[model samples]
Target chain A: MKTFEYRTAAGLAAGLEPGAVFLAGGTNLVDLMKLGVATPDVLVDVNRLPLHEVSGLPDGGIRIGSAVRNSDLAADHRVRTAYPVLSQALLAGASGQLRNMATTGGNLLQRTRCRYFMDATMPCNKHRPGSGCPARDGDHRNLAILGGSPACVATHPSDMAVALAAVDAVVQVDGPAGQRSIPVTGLYRLPEDTPERDTVLEHGELITAVDLPALPVAARSTYRKARDRASYAFAAGSVAAALRVADGLVADVRLAFGAVAPKPWRAYVAEEALRGQPATEERFRAAADAELAAARPLRDNAYKIALIRNLTAAVLTALAEDVR
Target chain B: MRLTVNGAQHHLVGLDPRTTLLDALREHLHLTGAKKGCDHGQCGACTVLLDGRRVNSCLILAITQQDAEVTTVEGLGRRGEPHPVQQGFLDHDGFQCGYCTPGQICSAIGMLDEAGKGWPSAVTEDDDLLSDREIRERMSGNLCRCGAYPAMVPAIRQAAGR
Candidate 1:
């Protein structure tokens, strides 16, 4: 491993620096560095500085600091009660040890779990600029179909992030310039051309917290992940659903998918299709199909089409039945 | 950086900045109780307690934990008196190679604390706390390559006295 200088930042202002990478849990960054995927000359440790807080916001929402552990957030009573999808998503990922170390901000900032990205010998645009994505024609069973370009087809490997996007969470960030909040939907950008740039976070910018707006609708939420294994595995297809029913019909619905897109794919079209409609298995199937209509699967990832549709329909049916 | 490890305060300096808490504990401090399997945090062999919360030591920076209280497996049980979880693991034969035992025990302590605090797991209802499904879901992160899950469950249940 390459040696790097490390500094402990006193606060957010002290942490922002050129060529310095902010270290939260280091679960992803350290693993990448060991694999020669990411080699920073300097690491600015941000695990301290008093950012680890999970509290209720004045606007009846919740503000979770970037340093808050995934385990803590998942265990938070308010999150469990109001946003069960978020808690379930967090729990579905990694292991107890990892969730304890992984922070909400780090979970969002985690890189794609594409095998090509990790293997330095492989040609991956997301890892090495201008190299190209080998997974497009290679083992792409786990690659993305939505919002992917010829340059890259890597899927975002975050369960919590997908749930957060489904609920329209706001990411609070601090940078050398100033502080600002970006909607979680707008945080991730499509591969388009620059697969190297995964998120809209600026240089020297640090994610301070994530603010999830109050949605009573999300009180009846669920997250379901289907993977190759029953436990401790990455998702092949996952769905996060936050639905509200009124008068025997769907009042509101927020749906997002993982392992099928470059970012968390919010099923806005499906949500629109469900509004004011009777909550039925047939309607859920239709909504799932509507959301996946635009999916462009690769040569080997065609199974994701069916996997996503079935998983989405199952999650929606469970939500409709109020089965948690 | 100064930290309280296993109730003993130790001052460390001039260590590798990129060195993880796992490396610091096992390599530098000779606290070899926490094993390093799959150093990528996928395995729970390097689990430890930081400020009463269980975390994968492989993912934590040594410098980032300045002055924090750390508990390793060595600190978890006395030389003669083993912790309830440790005793339970031994009684239930929760390991074959015993490589992931320290992490499993450390994680179980944290998991029991979470259950005691009325924290609900994924399958838990919004109103209820600590169900069998919740225990299983919350404990899913720890993997036993030896396939000792059946024994591990009973061990954890005994430790939690559920």
Candidate 2:
């Protein structure tokens, strides 16, 4: 470990210093540093800056502080009531001890669970610049197919973030330029040529909170994750769905898939297809097919095609029966 | 920086900024009650109470919690007087190596707090209130390598008196 200066910031301005990394929860950043992936010379502790709060907005939305623990945010009554998908997705992630330490902001910024990214010796585009993605031709069974570029195919591993994107949540960020909000959909950029850049956030910019807009459809939401284990595992492919039914017809629908793209893969095309249509297995299957039409799978990832299809069908079927 | 560990207040400076709270408690503060298993956030061996919420100390920076009150396994009880959770674990034989016991106890304490707040788990229905299944689902984040989950439920339930 290298020597570094540690300072506890009093406010966002105090924390956003040059060459200083804002430390919240330290779940992802600390682990990356230990793996020799990230090495910061100065750490700005933002845990005490008073961002840890989860409250209901006057507009019937919810404002979750960036520093709030994943466990707390997932269990919050407002979140569970308004966004059940978010709660379920959070619970599907790492064990209770890790959820207690992981924050909403950190969870959004967590790196991919790619084995190549963690192993420094491996040739990974996400970890090493210009080294190329080994998973592309190698064991890419878990790699992304939707928004991947030729540079990399690493999938975003956050379960809660996918649900947030599906519900059109807004991420509040604070920096030297002042405060601004970015839609969760725009938080991440497509791999394009630079797969190394995971998020659109600028350096020194800190996430303040996530504001989920009022969505009545969210009450009829569901999140289902498919992984190798029954617990304590990352999703291989997951679906977060929010649907509203009126007179046995789909009035509104929103769907987002995780661990299938560089960011949360929202099936807007699929949602549009389901809207104004009768909620039936045939419609659900068509919507799933439409959403996965753009998928470009590599070798050994043919299983994701069936996995995502089944998950999408199951989540939509569950939501179709849920009362708004 | 100052920390009150095991009811003793210690003010120290010039420590590594990247050092984890778990390492600080074990290496510097000499409170080795919390063990370090994975160093990554996957394992629960470094669980401790920071402001009454159980957190993986290995994932937290020592300097981040300068003024925050911390409670380790050692602080939970003295040699003769054990915490209810600890006693529950002992009665249930919740460990073989005992390395994960401290973290399990601390995480259970936090899990009970979460359940008391009426927080829903993954298996919770939108209309249904909490049940034993919800409790188990909520507590799934803490893993026991020894496969003590079967015993853990009764131990936590007995400690929580539910």
Candidate 3:
């Protein structure tokens, strides 16, 4: 491996190399480097940029610094009490030691854990654009069934991000062209034609923090993941849902799915179906079916459609009950 | 970068950015107690204490960690006396292969510290010490292919004075 210039967060934009990548926790970036998928010449250390604070925003929302470790973010009193879905999503990811080291920025920018993406030998459009996607025909059981173009079919692997989508979180980024705000929904573009771009973030853009608007309905949210194993396994399918039901009528709701799409899929149609509807399993099932109607599954990934349907229905039903 | 590894200060000036804290410890410092089971962060074999917090040394960049008090397995015991965790592991026969032992010990220390700091877990109430089931959940990160969990729990429990 070639050595690169190392510097602190100061003058980060000025010091950017052609292939420079910010090194936060090195959980995903280092692994990608080892796999030859990412060969950055410089790795700027952003761990010491005084961005670890979890502060309360004026909108009654919370602003979480990018450098904050996943463990600290999950255990923060405000996060646990106010955004339990986000906390639960964080806890559901990787092992304890990894979460202890992984920062919020790194976690959000994590590459897919897909086998093809990690193996340089395999033909992957995401790793090497236009090479060809071998996963479409081989070992694609774990790949995406939604928002997949012929060029790519990989899924976003972070659990924390799925919860962020449901709550409509805003990402604050600092780049060469000054600062800009991106909604969580717009952060990840569908893999319609640009399979190479996982996120819409421009090059040299550094995520400073994530701004979360206070949503009381979101406080009742929960993240439930079904994995191959009990621990250290990526989600086979997962749901982040927040439901507010009053007198058996859905007052408000939000829904998002993970490990089922190229990005954290905000179930907009599903939410539209649930809004003002009677809180019941029939309505929940119908909502899930409507959102999944456009899913284009490969030969090996048809199981995910059932998995998402059942899981979404189950989570919505549980959230709809008067169990608060 | 200067590191206070196990209470000893050492300066490394011309290290590569690709060099992990694990490589620095096992190769340069000759502290091989923290085994490199998997070069990737999936395995906890190279676990160590960074400022008294447990982290995978294999993924940590040494240059990024300036002045961090790194406590490895070599630093746990006093001159001739074994650390309580070491003794506990021995008394309970926590390992048959012993490759993941150091990580388990260090991680348990870190886990106990976290519990004292009121960290929550799925199995127990927030901030409580590991219950019998919670022990398995908390230590799930440290994989022991030797199937020594029956004895390992006793060892960690003994060390924790439970």
Candidate 4:
């Protein structure tokens, strides 16, 4: 690892600059630095910043401070009771120690687990632009199945962010320009031509908090992740869904997928297909099939389409059964 | 920089900012209880308590933990007076090679605390029972290549009662 200057800032705007990076939980960034993937000139320690609370918003929402640890966020009573999907998603990811050390903002900003990206020796467009993406034709079984480009096909690795996308969470950021809010779904940029750029945030823009809107239907939500192991592994494919049924019909629904795309894929097509439709296995499968119609699976990852389709149907069916 | 470990304060001078907490404990302080299995945080052998919570010491920089209270397996107990968890492990023979015992013990301590606080795991339906499945899921971060998990579950359950 390279030696760098370390500065502890009192506030968000204190010492942020061009090459200076904000360090929060240091789970992802520290690991990446050790792997020589992320090299920052200056490390601004943001642990002492005032952004550590999970407070209630005036609009019946909750504002999660950027530095709030993932374990604390998942254990928060309001999140557990009201936004169970978020809690379940956070618990389903990493492990107890990692969740204890990982922060909300850091979780959202974590990079993909693509082998080509992590390995400095491998040719990855995200690691070094114009180098080439080796994962496109090599070991892409765990790579992206949607929102991929010819340049890159890596999936975003955050299960928590997938749930946030389903719940319509908004991220509050403070930078040199000032403060602004970005919807969680809008926070990430698809890996199009520029796979190097992960998010829409500019350099020195620090995430302050993530606001989750109060949706009562989210209380019935859940998160299901399929992986090689029972725990402590990244999702092969996952679903975050919240369904509300009224009079044997789907009244409202929020759906999102993880480990399938460059970003947390909100299943808007499936949600659109399910609205006002009778809650049944056929309707659920059709909705899932409609959403997955855009999937262009690679040579090794064609199984993901079926896995995700079955998972989507099963999760929605389970949620729908909760009401009957 | 001054670090507080297990209640004692140590003032060290001219330490590199890039030094990880695991290196600081094992090399600088000569406290080798926290072993470095995987420096990338993949293995939990470097697990230690920071501010009463378990975290991968290998991933954390010692300079960043100047305020936290660090705890390792050595701080848990002494000769002839093992911590309840340690005693349970001994009674249940929770290891074959014992390489991952320190991490498993530290992680177990942290997991018990989390369960005590009603923190739910992914498989937790009502937070009522800390079943063997819950224990396995919670301790999934610490991998024992010797496959000592079968005995470790009862060891943890015994420790949980005490």
Q: Candidate 2's residue-wise lDDT over A1-324, tens digit each?
A: 555677777678543556567777778888888887766777777777778999889999989999999888887878877898898899888877778778899899988888889877788878888888888878788889888988888899999999999999999998878888999999998888888889999888889999999999898788999988777788889999988888989988899999999899988989888989999878988988998999998877767878888888887887776563
Candidate 1 clashes between residue pairs 3 or more apart in a chain or in different chains: A95-B141, A96-B141
In terms of TM-score, the best-performing candidate is 4
Q: How does model 3 fare in lDDT?
A: 0.86
List, residue by residue over B1-162, the lDDT tens digit for candidate 4: 999887899988999999999999989999988888988888899999998898999999899999889998989987899988898899999999888999999999999999999898988976564799998988988989999999999999999993
Q: List all candidate RMSDs to the true structure.
A: 2.1, 2.2, 1.6, 1.0
Best-to-worst order by TM-score is: 4, 3, 1, 2
| Candidate 3 local lDDT, A236-280, one digit each (tens) | 999999999987888899999999988999999999988899989
Q: What is the lDDT of residue A286 in candidate 2?
A: 91
Fnat, model by model in order, equals 0.75, 0.90, 0.55, 0.82
Question: Which of candidates 2 and 4 reaches a greater DockQ?
Answer: 4
TM-score for each of the candidates: 0.94, 0.94, 0.96, 0.99
Per-residue lDDT for A1-324 in model 1, tens only? Answer: 678888777668554556668888888998898888888888888876688999889989999999998988998889988998999999888877677788999999999999999998888998888998888889889999888999999999999999999999999998778899999989999998899999998878889999999898889998999998767889999999988877779888999999998899999999999999998888988988998889999989889988888888888888878742
Model 2, range B1-162, lDDT digits (tens) per residue? 787776688887877677789989999988888889888877788889887788889888787777788999888877898888888888887777777888888888877777677766667665443355665675665667878777877788788775
TM-scores for chain B, listed for all candidates: 0.93, 0.90, 0.94, 0.97
Which residue ranges in model 3 land beyond 4 Å of their true spot? A11-15, A322-324, B124-129
Give residue B127's lDDT in candidate 4 (0 to 100).
Answer: 52
lDDT of each: 0.86, 0.83, 0.86, 0.92
TM-score of 1: 0.94
